[model samples]
Target: MQRWKINLSVLWLGCFLVSAGMTMITPFLSLYLQEDLGVEGEHNIALWAGLIFASNFITSFFFQPLWGKLSDRYGRKMMLLRSGFGMSIVMVLMGFAAAPWQLLLLRMLNGVISGYIPAAVSLVSASTPKERMGFALGTVQSGSIAGTILGPLLGGLMADHFGYRPIFYITGGLLFLASTLSWIMVKEKFDKKAAALSAKTSMLGNLKKLMRIPQLPALFSVTFLIQFAMLSPMALIPLFVARLHGTSEDLAFWSGFVSAATGLSNMIAAPLLGKLSDRIGSFRILVICLLGAGIMFVPQAFASSVPELLVYRFLLGCFIGGLTPTVNSLIRRYTPDSSVSQAFGFNSSSLALGNMIGPITGGALSGLIGIEGIFIVSAASLLLTSLWTYRSLRRAGMGAEGRTG
Candidate 1:
């Protein structure tokens, strides 16, 4: 096999393991706080869970660009190994935490070291041929989506059969295994001396230079809005399911189904759309998918039953699948080869920012506008972004084929 193909295969597995490890503990975190860590009271456990969960993304939002910068000077595979090994150790220690504070601190540390996904993305993007960029990213994204969909299900079963602490050990072990495999199999032809020269400018200097490129800021906004629109309603989804179902019995099952429905379709759609992007154009597909996703959200706001919501969510996923990969491809198209890792790093930070803020904003807005209203706000945001993106690209004279500059 060719070197890029081998790297993609190994990195795909690495991305999957890390994505699964990040999400797996979520389903049982509250229980871990109450049972394993001996936290008392419903409010206290809920508060701790929210804090511990959000803390990771909060730190991640601030730190991703720094890692991205360093990765440009160093090598993407090195950054990938650092994050994989660091997160593996942190996750293992969480199993030994005697108190909630210890676990919270560890989660923050995990976030600070969390660059494996972005680094894998940078490695793949930089190495893959431009013509195949979309498909390669799409394939890698499918691995991530698959991991996300299955992680909670597996975690729940393991928590029931074994125990919470053991699940942590298992997750940590799996991360280490993925890292080890990546180290052995993934190959990067990184010219460290040249990369160091390209990255000689200070981080802020690079940020200003990249932002001055007209296409990047718009692309970055699309990244933030896509994540914001998708995640804002995630936490309140079960409540929405209950409201639509009109009963609490089997509510958890129905809610899980509705949530996974999107991912199931997304896992299927990403690669297909990515392949299509190679033949046509990524920007065109991005606009159409954004419009489609926005329209899907509208019907979801008016969904009268859980089944109706499920259908809308699944359709939305098909379009959401097209968003991220294309954005990465477009970023690569606009970035210099020497600085592509740093560009992707800033994009990752944008994604992290959306992840951190979306739920908080969603929770706050739910009280003022209601859950349905949040859906409407999300729909409106995407639709507006779609229109803005189209006009922005056209005015910049970037044709459907994209400018290689």
Candidate 2:
């Protein structure tokens, strides 16, 4: 196999492992606090769980660009390993946490070290042929979605049989195995001397330089809005599902199914849409998917039955699946080769920023506008973003059909 192909394959697995490891422990955290850590009272468990969960993204939002700069200076592969190993160790420590604060601190540290996915993106973008970049990024994205879909199911099963703390240990072991595989199999053509020469700009200097690229800021906004819109409705889905389901029995199952439905379709659509974008141009794909996803959300808001919502969620996934890979491809297309990692790092920050704030906003809005209103707001936001992205590309003189900037 060619070196780039080999690297893509391993990095895909690395992404899967990293995403799975992060998510697997998340579903059980509340239970862990209540059962294992002996947290009493509903309010306390909720507060502790929310804080511990958001702490990771809060730190991740601030730290991703720093790692991106380091990756550009050192090597993406090294950054990936650093994140993989760092997260693995931190995850294990969570299992040993005797108190909630320990777990919160560890989660914060885990967030600070979380860069495997972005680093993998940087590596693939740096190594893959430009002609195949869309497909490669899409494939990698599918791996992450697959992990996201499977992680909760697997974690729930393990937690039932093996208990919560052991789930952390198992997640850590899986991360270690993934990193070990990358260490042995993934090869980079990175030149340290050249990277050192290119990375002399301060992190702020790099950010300023990348922002001067006309299409990039819009691309970054689209990245942020994509995540923000999707995640905003995420935490409220179970209540929405319950309202539609009209029964408590199997409510959990239906909620899980609805959540996974989007990921399942997304995993299938990402690579397919990615390949399509390579032929038709990523800019066009971005606009269409954004519109498609936005339209799909409208139907979800009106869904009267669980099955209706599930179907809508699945359709939404098909469009949402295309957004991240296309955005990443576009980011790579617009960015200078020397600052690609830094650009992706900033893009990752946008994603982390959305992840951190989306749920809070959603929860806040759920009371004022109600759950259905949140979906309308999300849909509207996406449609506006699509228009903004279209105008941004037009002003930058990128034709809708242009394959490269």
lDDT of 1 at 226: 89
lDDT of 1: 0.82
Question: Cα RMSD to native, each candidate?
Answer: 4.6, 4.4
Candidate 1 Cα outliers beyond 4 Å, as residue runs: 1-10, 26-52, 69-78, 93-103, 121-142, 156-166, 180-199, 239-256, 275-281, 302-305, 335-339, 399-405
Worst 10 residues of 1 by lDDT: 396-405
Q: Could you tally the backbone clashes for each prediction?
A: 0, 0
Q: On a 0 to 100 scale, what is the lDDT of residue 102 in model 1?
A: 93
Against the true structure, candidate 1 reaches a TM-score of 0.77
Off-target runs (Cα >4 Å) in candidate 2 are: 1-12, 25-52, 69-78, 95-103, 119-142, 159-165, 180-199, 242-254, 275-281, 302-305, 336-339, 399-405
- What tens-digit string does per-residue lDDT give for candidate 2 at 1-405? 988899899989988888777766544565678778998854455456556666789998888768867887889899999999888898888899999999989988998998898788878988899999989987897788778887765665677677778888988988998899889998888888987777256778888998899888888888889988887777567667767878756555566577778888988898899889988888888899999999999988889999999999999999987999898888887788988878987887788888877766776676678779889989998999899889877788666455552
lDDT of each: 0.82, 0.81
Local lDDT at 145 for model 1: 73
